[model samples]
Target chain A: MKLSEILSLLEGTLVSEHADWDLEIGKVAAADLMSDVLAFADPESVLVTGLVNPQVVITADMADIVGIIFVRGKVPPPETVAVAREERIPLIITSYTMFEACGRLYQAGLKAVDLES
Target chain B: MSKVSQVTRLQELVYELEIAEVMTRDFLSVTPQMTMREFKEFLQEHRFSGAPVMEDGELVGIISIEDLIEALAAGELGCLVEAKMTRDPVVLKANDLVVRSVDYFGRFGYGRFPVVDDQGAIVGVLTKGDITRGLLRKLEVEYHQEEIRRARVNHIFDDVSSDHTSISLRYDVEARNFERGGRASRSIKRALKRFGLPRQIVRRAAIATYEAEMNVVIHADDPGGVITAEIQPDQIVIEAIDMGPGIPDIDLAMQRGFSTAPDWIREMGFGAGMGLKNIDRCADRMELLSPHGTRTTLRIVIYMDER
Candidate 1:
């Protein structure tokens, strides 16, 4: 699914300054732990996380996540937003809970990108 | 920045910067119902050469000083802006790359393009000057970051006079500093990246060093310790030494799922007993020495030629 479609499907608000609307995000990984993200998530997958911190952005950058969605209407602090903006990784906020958001994306044909091989 | 790299940097920035970052925001717009005389006065007051014409919060047309000049020449200053403004003006998307506007200006010969959001609401305006200023500003920021990085890591790669060149970097890691736990490894990773090492080597070294750093922070008994990376031409050897309550059985500690971390540590999403194994996987060779209660030294080596 395209990022723009996912945004609307989950009733998401793109809090970041810019996003690549046409960028295809075929996989999603939901994790609050930065270590799990680094260890298991594949590159180019969109991360659905409830944690809001600068470390989350750092982990996303290291793991090569294409974007981040903050579940449960969680708004990140300015420092976290600054890092994401500097790295050019899009950040979206959704009202749906983590489980609901994951289910919606999975139902929309996005595959899980965990359990690193 | 060097001249050659500066040129390449400029090329990179043009594609990286979006139109929203460069466009002029909170601009004044004129209503199409306003008379040409009123429009001329508004333009003079704001000193704007052109402005988007709006109706009910929507962009309807564009009127410029040239239109005012024609109105004056034709003795039609009393006419409404709708009669003389250009309808269906060309626009640029706020999320589009600035490079696209460069092409747009060259092809359309317009002095400025009104930038809009996905809903087609006029958000800002972009001119040639905006793009130039934006690129220069971004270039300056990038240059400063590059300079700082060079200054920090410059000593590691230069000033070697031995027949066998191996430069070592040491960073202190503080125990229980959860916020700063990854500092040492991050620095090592950045220094290796600046050295222009292969991507896989840099990644392996970074990951292994990070796991080691975390171990010190989580389990070390003393206040702090030191982690060092000795970089040789063929391999990089990383050693993380900590004054800690040493692991009693190295064999059991090496197990993938065995962890001695307390509940608080596990709550922080670490201490799955994977650190040692992760380091082992990334390093070409690994060594661990933990004398019952004295200290723990974890050494990891990665070769340049190895997979």
Candidate 2:
């Protein structure tokens, strides 16, 4: 899905100045463990997590995650926001819990890449 | 023994710091009314990067060794804490996640931050050294965990006698997604380690394999391609197969500045034609094969002793 469309669907607040209007998203993983995310997330997708550390941004930077979403009312620290801005990956804040958020996106015709997609 | 470069370089550092067992007890104090001579002496006595300043028993500010040095150079040792100390020192609670400490490192590149108590009393000092050592310790622990994962990756490949023939990854191309792009490689690296591959081999293979996988998704149109990586006792082979119309000039494609990747890829600091060169540079042996509708296959060999 187009990043623009995903942002609108998730009720996201864009925290990045470098987000492309045309960047497409290929997959999404919702978790907070930086290691788990690093160990598992498909680097072709966005990271949706309840955690709000700057490492999230650093990890995103290292992995090239297209975007970061802070779920369940978690707010990013200023440094976290700054890194996101510098890396130009979109940072979004969503009030949905991880499960609900993942479910909503999963059901929103927001299909994740199948092992064969 | 030349591997001593990596192994011995860290020994003295680890040895010196191991003495204190990484003290977290933030024992320090400085009074603004204290003489400048005294502050400079405190800096020297404690080997301080910085110290918190107090006034009437109240935490008022901080004096960094940097500021003290600057004062000395400026012939200002007689200067008061008000003059030499930073009025506001970034302080953190003793219980703050060490990860947050890392964030501070990433953000301001600080050498240290003050640790304070509920009453604003300085409890201890967290040096860039301490945090870094802490991170190293944590990473060491994680590295041990990674050993298991490395085994898994190794089992996937080396245990040809086992079940890991092909890694089936489901991903989309041109998504500009960063986080998921390297997942398969992480797994691959872990498996390689499990198979007892050397760290150098693991690093080189991971880079070449991940870079190849990332390119497939970020640059190619084929979502149907399979990245098949295999391990031989002699070398590691990574094959990225896709149905996308292949590049015309293999040589030009190998050139460092010849990437046709979109602007986004360039902005990510990777899509430089160097991906191929980087793969070539890291691998002792590399073979890239592409035929129209052509799958790109990269073979990298990391010698056992090399790691």
Candidate 1 Cα misplacement greater than 4 A, ranges:
A15-24, A77-89, A114-117, B1-161
For every candidate in turn, the CA RMSD to the true structure comes to 8.8, 18.3
Error of 1 at A17 (Å): 5.6
- Each candidate's fnat, in order? 0.10, 0.00
Residue-by-residue lDDT tens digits, candidate 2, B122-150? 66777767856764675476568877876
Model 1 chain B: lowest-lDDT 10 consecutive positions: B152-161
lDDT of 2 at A98: 86
* Per-model DockQ: 0.20, 0.02
For candidate 1, please provide the TM-score of chain A on its own.
Answer: 0.97
Task: Give candidate 2's whole-model lDDT.
Answer: 0.66
The lDDT, on a scale of 0 to 1, for candidate 1 is 0.86
| Error of model 1, residue B197, in angstroms | 2.5
